[model samples]
Target: MTLTQRQAAYEAEVLRRWQDQSDGAHDLGHLRRVWRNCQTIALAEGGADTEVLLAAAFFHDLVNLPKNHPERAQASRLSARAAVDWLATQGFPAEKLPAVEHAIAAHSFSAAIPPETTEARILQDADRLEALGALGIARMFYVAGAMGGALFDADDPLASHRPLDDRAFALDHIEVKLLPLVHAMQTTEGRRMAEEGADWLMSFRSRLLREIG
Candidate 1:
C-alpha cells in the first residue's frame, strides 16, 4: 500500500529522531529490528500501508526515556508524542492519530499497553518478536552488556524465582521473556519466524544450562 505524503514524512522524521535519541543497545537499534519484523509480517497480512506500518514500527519503542531506562516502568506516552506531533504537521487525519499513538504507547512490554488496532497488534508482535530466536538472543546479551549486566552465572540473582529487581529482570529476560515469544506472536509469518527463533534460544539455553548448571 502507498503512504500519503504526510505518512511518508511522518515516518522519515520519526526514524531520524529515534536514531538520534538512542543508539546501538538503547532503543534505536531495537526499533529498527521491530521495523524490520513489521515489514516481514506486513507483507503477509495485506491491506496495510507499508509505510504507515513501518512508521509505527519505527516509533513503537520510541516510548520511555532513558531516565526511566530499562525497567523503571514509566508511561511511554512521551515516547509516542514526537511521532504524534509530526503526523499532525503532515496533515495526517486526526482520527488516525489515536490509533498511531495507541500503538506507539502500547508497544512497550513494560507499559503493558497491548495493541488495540490491527496495525498496533502487528507492531507489538514484531517488536516482541525481536526478543525471540537467534537475533533475540543476541539482543538480550547486547542489552545486558550495555546495561553493565554480568555474563552468565548459575548463581546470578537475576535467575531467581521472581524475586529479583530491575537489574535482575534485565539480565534474566532471556529465560523469563525471550523464551516464550515464539508462541506469543500475532501473525502467521511472525509465528513461523518466532518458532525458528525460539527453537534456537531453547537449544542455546539448554547447552548453557548443561554446561553452566
Candidate 2:
C-alpha cells in the first residue's frame, strides 16, 4: 500500500479502537488536533520524521486513562506498548518502530519522561500544545465537568488563600499546571505558540477575576 493509503487505514483503525473507549478531552478529535500540531511543528522545526511522528500521535493516547487515575503517570508506557504491538502486526516500518515508541512513551507530562529523539520531542511538544490556547480552555472545562470539578472557587478564584487544588476546581489548573507549560514546550515553534496561548489564558484570567469581583 502507498503511504497515504496506509495512513488512512491506520486512522480508521484508530477511530474504531477509540470509539467506545474515549472521554471528551482524549477523544479522536483531540488526536486529530495533535496530529495537525505535529505536522505544523515538523514543517517549522525541520528534520522531524513525519511517519514516526504521525504514528506516535495516533497511538499516544491508546491507553486513555483518566487524568485523575492513580496510575496516570504510567498511561504513556502502556500506550507505547500497545502501539508497538499493533504496529508490528500492521507492518509499520520496523526501523522506525523504536522512534515511534519513544515518541509515544514520552509525550505525556505525567510520564515525566524526557524526549530523547527529534520525533519524540516534536510529539511531546505537539501534545502539550493542545493543553493551551482557546481549545485548551474548552478542554479544561470538559474534563473538569466530567470529573465533577467546579468552575472555580467563588471565594478565591485565584486560589490566593487556599491551596490550589485542580481536583476540586478547574480554574486553578492554570496556575497549578498550564501556565508552567509555557516554558516546558520541547520545540522552538511549540514554545513560541505556547507563549501566545499563555498570553491569551492570562488575559482570560484577568477578565474572569474582574467579572467575579
Candidate 3:
C-alpha cells in the first residue's frame, strides 16, 4: 500500500521509536505485516476507515510493555494516548482522532476491549494474526528463550495430561493462546489467514511430538 507523504513520515517516525523499545517479534517488520493484513482485510471487509486502520497499525505497539508486566493490558490504552498526542503534533485530522485512538486501544488481547468500530475490529484481527503462523512459532521460541521458558514439557508436549502454562513453556502457548485467535478474528480474510496460520502451528506441534516420541 502506498502511504501518503504524511503517512510515510509517520511510519518512519514510528519505526525509529520502535527500534529502541520493541523486541524482535514486535519490530517494524511485524508492524508492516499487520499493515498489509489491515489492507487486505479492509478491502475484503469493506466500509472500514482505512486511514484510522493504517495509523493504528503504526501506533498499536508504540507503548509495548513486557509480556509479563503487571499492567500489560494497560499498554494499549497508553499507546492510544501517546499516538493521539503525537498525531496531534503532526497535524492529523481532528475529526478522526477518536477513531484512530479507538483502533489502537482495542487491538490488544490483554486489554479485553471489544472493538466497536470496523477499523478497530480489523486492526485487532490483523494484530492477532501475527500470533498464529510460522512467525508465531519463531516468536514463541524467541520470547521463550528471552524469558528462560522451557521449550516444552518433556513428558507432555501437547499439555494433554497437564495444565497448560505458557509462562513456563513456549510450546504450550499455541494451546493456551494462539489456537483461540482463530475464533476471535473479526474479518473473513483475517479468519482465513488465521486458520491457515493455525494449521502451520498445529503441523509443527505434531511434527515435534512425532520426532520426540
lDDT scores in order: 0.67, 0.88, 0.89
RMSDs, each prediction? 3.8, 1.3, 1.7
Shift of residue 64 alpha carbon in model 3, Å = 1.1
Ranking by TM-score: 2, 3, 1
- Regions of model 3 farther than 4 Å from truth: none
**Model 2 spans with C-alpha error above 4 angstroms:** none
lDDT of 3 by residue, 52-105 (tens): 888999889888888888999899999999999998887778899999999999
Residues 1-213, candidate 1, lDDT per residue (tens digit)? 344553455456656765655445545556567777887787888655554576676666554455336653554667678777876776666777777787778777677776667777788778778777776677777677666766564466345554544344454666567766666667788788878887887787778767765
Candidate 3 least-lDDT 10 residues? 1-10
What is the C-alpha RMSD, rounded to one decimal, of candidate 1? 3.8
| Model 1: worst 10 consecutive residues (lDDT sum) | 162-171
Predicted structure 1: lDDT: 0.67
- Superior by TM-score: candidate 2 or candidate 3: 2
- Enumerate clash totals for all models, in the order shown: 1, 0, 0
What lDDT tens digits, residue by residue, belong to model 2 across residues 73-159?
999999999899999998888999999889999999988899999999999888888889888899899999999999999998988
**Candidate 1, residue 100: how far the Cα is off, in Å:** 1.1
lDDT for predicted candidate 3 compared with the true structure = 0.89
